[model samples]
Target: MTQKQRIDAFVSLGNFLRSDDQKLDILLDNASIKNPWYTKNNVRKQLATLSANLTPENLQNWLVGYPDVTVDQTVGIILAGNIPLVGFHDILCVLIAGFRAQIKTSSDDAGLTSFLMQELITIEPKFATYIDIVERLSGFDLIIATGSDNSSRYFEYYFGKKPHIIRKNRNSIALLTGNESAQQLHQLGFDIFDYFGLGCRSVSKILLPKGYDIAVFFEAIEEFRPISTHHKYTNNYDYNKSIYLINGDKHFDNGFLLVKEDERLASPLAVVFFEEYADLAAVTLNLENSASSIQCLVTEATIETSIPTFPLGGSQSPRLTDYADGVNVLAFLMDHATQN
Candidate 1:
């Protein structure tokens, strides 16, 4: 497909997602059945955010930096199913870069991605030949895969010989100055509660100034109490709360979420780990040491640090340029195109 054709197809898809059509209802129902974590409201919110970013202008701006090339290669992608449509961006990148995508969808998220792909094929029939949804990925010039650290070891053993971008487990963190406004802190709740903290960009841990009042942070996020109502989420919350209580661990609980002072980057679902920092230097040093495990550092204060920081609530709504794991996917594909 031509550049215009590709842009038009995505724009049509964005419009379709924005419309109040019954098709979305059906898709959401199927998605929820496939994975209870994909509640209808969560799926709808995620799709709406993605659709807004799929505008023609955004697509053009994102593509303008890359060299134009006509190349045909099969790119195998192993997608993660942690959050709703988490792998859509990779598929979009592959198509826009003029490569055929052999996608192995995570069983938890296959229905929604397939539905969107069918919509795109309807908009531009040529895409039907460029896209393939497969049970297994093989015979590809290059590969991009996302999985946990354990699975990444397996991916490395299997796909290491081929040029690939194999992404392992990474979690996001927030740096709190203890001086943020109520609104900013409230928005931080979305960073935590959205997707039930399943995505790599979700803030699983936080760094706070010494002696910060933890209660104030809890109060700011009271609006998100409804998250506890989800049966699956409530089960995790209750189970974690019981473990903490039975073990005599001291942690703050607001009945919906738990805040524990732990020096860990990866937090359990229904829990947000926090650490007290003596100064900016300490936080910077800690982040530098943990660079490999951190995906995003959300904050409002300006710190002289190399870690990429997004404002509170912006982690989940990444622009097209926000490549996962800081890998320049377009450049990677374009370079392969040139070599091929």
Candidate 2:
């Protein structure tokens, strides 16, 4: 395939995933087996944005960056189920780069990914030879695995000899200047509540300016009351509320959610914690401790030269081509292909 043809194939892949508008609706509406972490609109939003990001022009530029990747190698992927269809990028990257993908789909979030993959193969039947969804993963040249901290340890031990990218549980955080507009802080709700805060990119903590009032934060989030209407989310909120209060754990009340002041990255859903900071430098040092478990940081204040910054809600809706490890995926995949 010509470089443009391969790039067009990727764009078509995204189009295929987005084309099943009705099926997408049905999956979003009823795909919840029992514990639902996503809704149709959430899935739709992700698909729409990711689709736009994989445009032919962008994919072509991506191909230019990698000048040494060989397309013949097959990559095995162990996907995470923390959020719905979270591992689509990995599949897309492998195919776009010209290698076949051996996928181990997560049982919890497999419905949509399989559907999308089926669509991709339909768009270009040749993709069938490149994509395999398997129950058990075996031999492959490279591996990309996402799992919990414990599972990541196992992945590293088992796939240690191969060229692999293994990801453990990571959380996102927000850096508050305490001067954010109500609109900006309200958008923070998307960071905290999207995908019911189950995605690795969901903001689980806020680094606050010293003596910041929790009242303002709660007021900003009040507009996002629609999120509470989801049954599973409400249950998590209420159940965790009782456990923490009964245990006398220190947490700030927000009427709809809870915030506790702490130095940790992972917090219960419908709850967020804060850590006061007098110096951004000091906060930067503290965050380094959790960097492995931290996915992205949302900030209103100027990030210190050392801290990474992404837009406030970019966590929940990452671009399709934004590969993990700060790598540009399409570039990585197409590095070895000679251009037409």
Candidate 3:
């Protein structure tokens, strides 16, 4: 299929996602049962994001700067299952670039990803020739893989020689200036609690000014206390709280989440680490020093920082152009396809 055909296919898929479909709800419900982490609500949240952004205008704007990829290449995609349909963007990138995609679907999220692609083929039968769900990825000119830190080592070792985009574990950070309104902090709660904080975009840590009142944050996020009702989330919260108490560590506990002061970017599930900053420069330097480990920064638009900031609660709803780990998957494909 040509570039316009591919764009139209995705636009149709977007409309399909936006429509009220009883089957889609059933799929999400069944998926939640298969993997408790893929809660129906979380899957729908991502679906909503895709629905909102997959417009013709958004796709056209995103592609305007890039050259049209006329070269035909096969891309091997090893997907991650940390969140519902987490690897869909990579697949979309390959498809939009007019490359054949052989996807190694995550065992945790195959049902939904499989269903979406099948729907795409239904909308545009020609897409069937361009997409495949495989048990093992092979015979591809390039690859894109997402996994944890340890799994990334395996990916690097195996796919090193191939032109590939391999991503390791990354956690987002929220920088607080103590001037945020209750509504913003409340929205930040979604960044922290969404997907039960499993995905890299989740705000695993918060940066606070010294002398900041922790209770203010606690009060604002009280609305999200329902997140604790999940047995999995509750178990993690209980385990982490007990560990802290046993170690005699100083920490603050809300019913659903634990807040502790630590100089770490990645926090455990159900726990959010925080560090008090005496000066913004020190925090900026600290973040810069550890930029590789950080996925994205979340803060108020008005806050001045050396690095770019994502508005509060915007981490999860990444746009089509918001390539993962700051690597443009589509650009990578188009630039390197000639060599392949």
Local accuracy of candidate 1 as per-residue lDDT tens digits, 1-340:
6777788889899999999889988888988887999999889888988898899899999999676655679999999999999999999999988899999999788388889999999988999999999998878989999999999999999999998999999999998999999999999998899999999999999898999998899899999999988999999999999999999988989989999989889999999999998888777887988887888888998877666679998888888888888898998999898897
Query: What lDDT score is found at residue 264 in candidate 2?
Result: 68
lDDT of 1: 0.90
Q: After superposing candidate 3 on the true structure, give the runs of residues whose Cα lies further than 4 Å from its correct spot.
A: 301-308
Candidate 2 wrong stretches, greater than 4 Å: 16-20, 33-35, 67-70, 305-307, 327-340
Question: Highest lDDT, which number?
Answer: 1
lDDT of 2 at 78: 93
| 1-340 per-residue lDDT for model 2 (tens digits) | 4455656776887676567667766667765643366566677777776787677777776566554343667789999887777888888777776777999988787477787778777767877788889888886878888898899899999998987778877788898877899888888988988777888788889998899988898888897788778887889889989988899998877666888876667888788877898987788778776665677788776655333467676667666545564555555445433431
For model 1, state the Cα shift of residue 22 in Å. 1.5
**lDDT for residue 96 in candidate 2, whole number 0-100:** 70
lDDT of 3 by residue, 178-208 (tens): 9899999998988998889998989999999
Per-residue error (Å), model 3, residue 238: 0.8
Worst ten in a row by lDDT for model 1 = 63-72
Q: Estimate each model's TM-score.
A: 0.98, 0.90, 0.97
Note each model's CA RMSD in angstroms. 1.1, 2.9, 1.3
Per-residue error for 122 in candidate 3, Å, reads 0.4
TM-score of 2: 0.90
Candidate ranking under TM-score, highest first, comes to 1, 3, 2
